[model samples]
Target chain A: MDEKDKEILRMMQDDFPIVPKPYKRIGDFLWMDEVSVISRVVKMMQDGKIRYVGPYFNSAKLGYSGQLMAINVPEDKIEAAANAINKYDEITHNYLRAGEPNIWFTLMTPNEKRAEEIIEAIKKELAIDEILSFKSKKTFKIKVNPA
Target chain B: MKIIDERTEKVLKEFQNNFKIETRPFKRIAVKTGLTEEEVIAIIAKAKEDGIIRRVGIGVRPALTGFGMNALTAWSVPPDKVDSFGEAAAEIQNISHCYDRECPEGWIYNIFTMIHASDREELENIIKSLSERFPECPYKVMETLKELKKTSMKYFK
Candidate 1:
């Protein structure tokens, strides 16, 4: 990406305005025309540089409770375990990380009971003896602007 | 309980990921969600004011971008130090997420921080700097080997 593309990305990460004509507002800030700004954003999206552009809702306010779950899946069973966990749409993020609990994922549901129910199902499906789950007690920061 | 009205839900459901990429994006959304441009803007702007909408922004693919190495480092912070540690970590530009979570039995890591860097060396350096800041708290850097699944939360649909 060019320097101008990078600048546009930084603006997107910081805040894409909520307005009828957001591209124009962004154009006003960067001294570019609305058409140029929109084209660059489109190009970036086509290039796979941009994942998604929209509003990031506060999950808690939306009545969703989330927890971080870790399961120590044996090396041979990693694939099966991941497949089982990934079957649920509630599992938004699943990753294979280096540690004792090699598999970690985030599960968010409408309430704690549903979250627990999914946890139990995963355990049963995997035949795993234990899964370590951590619910957020306090959120200090969550602005994931990695531009 | 659903705090938002059905119409607002419809707007969110449509715009979360499939937001238009045109100059008049909201105008397009208005067309799709059957709301007027002004009404759509009003709902989104009010949601932003109410803190339900964190920001109308873009989520970049860090791994696809220059930032290929990401780690979810868990730290064992004492109750008294968690607030200070969280505040300090949050201030760092590279540190994206910091949270205090309940530790499961036999686990000591309570404070979790997510960091992304361009490479392994840079990730280690960032963790080293964090270690220096909170020398007393031991941490485990769970370097991601693979992203099995990563997607936005589908609240309505």
Candidate 2:
């Protein structure tokens, strides 16, 4: 991606304008036609640089809750544990990290009871009870638009 | 307040992935949901205004770009310093996700920041600078070894 392409990628990170023709509006600012701009975005998407492009919702505002849960898995069992955890529809992000709590994931549920139930279920399934869940007391930042 | 009916919920679920890029994208969405283009657009607008829709924009892979080797760094902050620390941590461009998590016993960390940079060196430098800034507070940087799964949960079944 060239400088101009990067600029376009960066520009698309913001809340897309709510207009009749959103791409055309963006194209006018980029000094390119709507078709060309759309094509460029398509190319970037195919390149795997752009993971997705759609409406990112505020789940909490829409009556949902989330928590960050970390589990300490052995180096060899990491894959097995992740596979088991990922099977749940509630699991959004699961990652292998280097630390005492080797595996980490974030799960969202409709309510506090459901959240606790799911966590307990995972603990029983894995047979590792010490799962440290760190709930956000206050959120300073959440979205990170990578340029 | 905007109403969220079957129409809006359908759009939210069906278009979670593969939001087709086109000249008139909403027209395509309109056809799928059996709604007019204008109605489709209005629903999305209302969702945004209601804060249900955070934003409609591009989502890119950070590691594919210059920003690679992302890690979550935690800082030990006093009760009085959490608000101030969280505010300062949020302002940094490289430091993307920051939050004040619950402070449990045996863990001094209350402030966690997700730092992303082009390479390990850059990430290290950022951490080093942050540590230097707050010499009193000890920090722990947990490196991301592998991504087990990364996907937004589908709100609508």
Best by lDDT: 1
Model 2 achieves a DockQ score of: 0.70
- Model 1 residue pairs with clashes: none
Which ten-residue region of model 2 chain B has the weakest summed lDDT?
B11-20
The sequence of per-residue lDDT tens digits that candidate 1 reaches over residues A44-122 is: 9998889788988899998888899899888899999989999999999999999888999999999878887898999
Relative to the unseen true structure, what is the C-alpha lDDT of residue B47 in candidate 2, on a scale of 0 to 100? 82
Q: Report the lDDT tens digits of candidate 1 across residue range B102-121.
A: 99888999999999899999
Q: Fraction of reference contacts reproduced per prediction? A: 0.90, 0.82
Global lDDT scores for all candidate models? 0.88, 0.81
Cα lDDT of model 2 overall? 0.81
Worst 10 residues of 1 chain A by lDDT: A138-147
Per-model TM-score of chain B: 0.93, 0.88
Candidate 1 Cα misplacement greater than 4 A, ranges: none
TM-score of each: 0.95, 0.93
